[model samples]
Target: MTGRRVRVAVTGMGVKCPAGNDPEDVFRRVLHARPTAAVVPGLAEAGLPVRFACTVPEFDLAPYIGRREARQIDRATALLLCAADDAVAGAGGAVRGPGHRAGVHIGTGIGGLPGMEEVVYGHGERPMGMPVHTVPKSMANSPACRLAMRYGLRGSCMTYATACASGTNAIGEAARRIRDGELDVALTGGVDAAVTKVIVSGFARMRALSVRNEAPELASRPFDADRDGFVMGEGAAVLVLERWDLARRRGARIYGEVAGYATTCDGAHAVAPDPQGAMAAECMRLAIADARLTPAGIGHINAHGTSTVLNDLAEAVAVERCFGPQSPPVTAVKGVTGHLIGGSGAVEALVALLCAARGVVPPVATTASTPDVGALDVVLGAPRQVARRPVLSNSFGFGGQNACLVLRPAP
Candidate 1:
């Protein structure tokens, strides 16, 4: 098993985001370049610097979980659970096997932030009184633990907290385990519910949020010359990964193959990306190499375009460095969904897979300004049709954490 490399198949995916809940619906919304960012009901009244966000609209837990059980869990955990249920069901029920052969890997930048805020500020009559379930609900690993318990998976249950790269790292690590024969099945993705007052205000203080309060839809303009910053978003995405052979044997509907993955760090700045994007380019090259393919094989890139000035520029530079001036067309989904933080990578990965399978790339929403970063072919205005080929998805985080995954259309 040391030198062996087994393919990992993405059999099922579920998403709950600002665009929609169902994966297809969300994909369609993005394909049409419909922006979801809008002013939160009370944010302006709260006097926050940023008043707009892309939030999961009208989510009810009663349909996905028992009412009593939902009461004990945080919104983040509940979101993950709902997505997990959909993913498993989409995978033709659970992957029936020994419990130890399965695992749960979930990622989140800040877990249960709303729940923690409630505990700190008191809920209803309880003034600063901690609830018994507060600890479990607020824990970063709660999503993974709860998923494992719900599905009876006894293998490793892990959570990644690498800022925005958390989801990509979790999915990449789970694929590595399966490729190394350590696990047969894994539930891997990311979720974050950080739309609380504290989280929003914190990012606002950092000046990381877009202030296009008058027109929230146009706020997240990735790679656009007028791009200022990102808009905070909340959502969850889960994917069911299984060994390629096992998936074929079980007759699962494979969406795509997780062909390669690589992660790297810049070690340069805590919040700013390296202007040259040297390490980011290296991460992409490494992932391509891991997939046993060259840069020429990549069809397009699903950029980790956070809509921030530095991030979009750095990513543009990285693309140029990785694939040269004639790089494949690039698209950023953050313009449609805003920045989902930890969940952005997983959701964008799903979009990449969809692009590969459907033979088209969605337009980067609401970006009217010319790209300031050289001659990169940024997809805009309308979806671009292309040959079905492997797609490279990127996720870069605040602490210089960068992760890349290459997904190929199902054979």
Candidate 2:
């Protein structure tokens, strides 16, 4: 424990994205610059503040999920479990045997909100009676439990709800557990299907959602001066993480190594990031240090670019402050995936892994010009192939919950 260097290998992967459900299809779609977001069916007629979202369409859940379990679980957990199958299967089915060797650390920002909102907002329903499976299913831990039960992972099954940072934190914590010798493999990622009527209205009230109703696909313009706010999006991403040695021993397909993880707090603002973004920079620095590297080692970054003005700027500033003018290629996925809220980081972390593995930088879409573009290498227009290896990924939440992860191509 004292001397052995810990390396977290991402062996399996799956994506339940708007463009596609299958991981392979989604990855190809992203590479080809396909659109995944559109106006949801029959929602615009209801006059919801946000009319469009990145939704998986023409898809039957039963084919990928069991009808009995799907009925009891929220869509968030359902998608997570579906994605988990591909992930563990990618891990070479080593999740078998004593469940204690495996764990589930899935993250979600809004747990059962659509279902919970239905029960609570239904004025016709009785005031006191709880839904048959309200508490357990609506709890944030539900996704973790459902994932664990679905995959027989009995160890460290839990959930983290750090707003948009939730998924990344869960994955980071899972990496820690494996590094600390608590588990050998983990199903790590995030899911959120909470883009509901009430949730959209809430964001509209706060003006945190893009009002590009007529131009839904062109919304979520991160780092652009004209960027208003992030468009709400929903999806699930899953990655099977294992100790590098174990993955190599099993001859599993490796995506990347979870080389470093660092989380910090500003404690300066309730919701807004510190304008200086010093603490955020430190998080990146600390992550690099944990990976036993320096700022110059990073070849790319997957930013927590929510398409919101402040967030994009703050993140850009933080990266520059941390890595100086030599900041590597920076890319924002929110523009394409929309903002998955709690699931943002974990899903984007996968984008980072892909960037390092495939040596292609994902382009930030619908973006115009950033004031600090000179400092940040914002990948745009097209996917750029670079000699990328270790990349930094960031996710900052409302309560100052910020987690940075350094991932590198599999050695």
Query: Which model scores highest in TM-score?
Result: 1
Give TM-scores for every candidate, taking all chains together and pairing residue i with residue i.
0.97, 0.95
Residues 257-284, model 2: lDDT tens digits: 8999999988887778887789999999
The sequence of per-residue lDDT tens digits that candidate 1 reaches over residues 205-243 is 988899988899999988889988999998999999999
Check candidate 2 and list the clashing pairs: 164-341
Report lDDT (CA) for all predictions: 0.90, 0.81
Checking candidate 1 for backbone clashes, the offending pairs are: none
**Which has the greatest lDDT?**
1
Give the CA lDDT, 0 to 100, for residue 364 in model 1.
91
Residue 85 in model 2: lDDT: 75
TM-score of 2: 0.95
